[model samples]
Target: MRPPCHAVLPVIACALGALFHATQAAAALKPAQLAIVINDADPDSVAMGEYYRKRRGIPATNVVHVSIPGKPRSIGVAQFRLLKQAIDSKLGPSIQAVLMVWTAPYAVQCNAITAAYTLGYDARQCAHTCAAGQPSAYFNSASKRPYTDHGLRPSMLLPTALPPIAGPPASLAPEQARQGAQALVERGVAAGARSLPASAYYLATSEVARNSRAGFFPPAGHLPAHRLTIRRMTADVLEGAHDVLVYQTGMAQVAKLETLAFVPGALADHLTSHGGDLLGSSQMSSLRWLAAGATASYGTVSEPCNHWQKFPNSAVLLRRYLGGDSAIEAYWKSVAWPAQGLFIGEPLAAPYAVASN
Candidate 1:
């Protein structure tokens, strides 16, 4: 026989209380520690820069502008060094994170733009290409400022939809790009009040090689009360889910994407080849998630990084976010090997930073 409803109330209350207490101890990253980098040569970059500065209230001194040709998806090592030097000279040493407001030149040869800025461009980091690079100092750290804490600064790209013909599109016609960028700020602000309806996580168990990441999924019953609800699925794909906060899976292409409804501050990513190569059309690009309404996403820039450790750990990503880290910080910390990974999205969204009522 089952216990009466009244008898179960105490146990439920205890679980909720424990969750509330854990959330209360979390910490958040400050906006002042972030710097905005704009590619002045690109019109779309300039427009997005202005919009982000106004939306995030970033100080004028913290905004650094550099001139680089808009064509060619990659830049030479020397060119990247000069660009990095200009940024360092302009922003000083106080800033710990950067938001690059352009999509072109996402790579500096073999290195992703985000990795180049954060760890500095070095052939050694990409010597093996598929092999892991040096581990990040910012990974799983509790420091408020990365510069002071780890001597390493992390960065994220505020991606723009590429023009159909390789030239800049009508400046005003880029409203779709602005929608995703604006959503990040709006969602971060909204997170401070009400939590999303529910949070869903998907784990695919069909393919043995791709299923390596499934072990990290947290038990559903252990999740926080009324804040996030987790569901673990063994199917190869998940569909028709609503109000998704965090979605992780692995596949060459994820079908039925329209069936999932993402909350404004949601974070979603798939472990797949070329998902990080936003310029490629062969596989589903990570940018599609942003277009589909997710605030942030990640993917590998090159071929065949089958190492599960090279990707983001589902549990670490969720726990860090729930502990009040911003999307960038939590995402950076979740990945053990980020040298080849491209992190693109709104860096400052923090849904779990809100206080419980």
Candidate 2:
């Protein structure tokens, strides 16, 4: 997902909701020591920072909301340096994560700073521009590579959630989709033979496109789940990999969430005033597809789904991916009337299997 700082940055204000809405025995991250860097003086961003901290139990002081004044979308190298200087002055090395929440001031510029944070690069060493197709491509002049997806960093010890790509496929026609899929297959084959963890890719189908009311299952015409289609395709292309996985997240359920999505006040301001589609609810089907069966997530940005009424489907898929015992049970639990009594896991874990003699 894009970092909080970008031409159209989408930060994880509600990601904290996903991260720590409930308590479990598993280890959880402390929200304190996390700094939220905002450039625009948008009260919504500030309110979000406060909403999450207080409502979610994030330590108040941990949320630092900074405003950059009169800064253009493209901050020249000089202005970039000054912005960095200001951030570094107040930045305590103890800060765990940085959320750049500016959408109007410039998302690409925001990416410049946040990229530095993710890469473990010295904030001062951040450059001014990133090349096309490069991670920091849309970032302002003082940008830096924030690892593969520009915002996601690979954890040395744990498996990271791979991001899923959203938006229109490179090819819209069946033939183009076939060709594109074939190319990706070839690339995976090469990467797998080299013994590297393969890049995972998934797609979401629109409701009208598939003519389905539900959102979790792919229609008959589309590619199936990881085991049947994706993994099979990967095997066909590449040799010698036991752990790599290729999969397709379902689309039927996602459409439900899309129908329910409403742009929040803060992001609405960005889109209306600044002329960009920065704020709105994520497609439920899209989020499920992203979270399916991955230890972590990466890819195009999707809005947080915790607050939505139609989010139980998302929770079910998340539970399934995160270790919900069974998708059916997870769905039932999430949809049960008491709503507040549901005991979904905090860090949804993979389901534990029963041993047979």
Q: What's the TM-score of each model vs. the native?
A: 0.85, 0.34
Quality of model 2 by C-alpha lDDT: 0.27
User: What C-alpha lDDT values do all the predictions have?
Assistant: 0.71, 0.27
Candidate 1 per-residue lDDT, tens place, 144-223, comes to 67877787778899875522222223333566556655665566555555555767676775655666666666556536
Question: What is the TM-score (0 to 1) of candidate 1?
Answer: 0.85
Any runs in candidate 1 off by more than 4 Å, and if so which? 1-25, 162-173, 354-357
Q: lDDT of model 1 at residue 317? A: 74
The clash count of every prediction, one per candidate, is 0, 29
Candidate 2 per-residue C-alpha lDDT over 12-61 given as tens digits, one digit per residue, 9 for 90 to 100: 22242342222221222233434555444655345434433443355545
Clash pairs of candidate 1? none
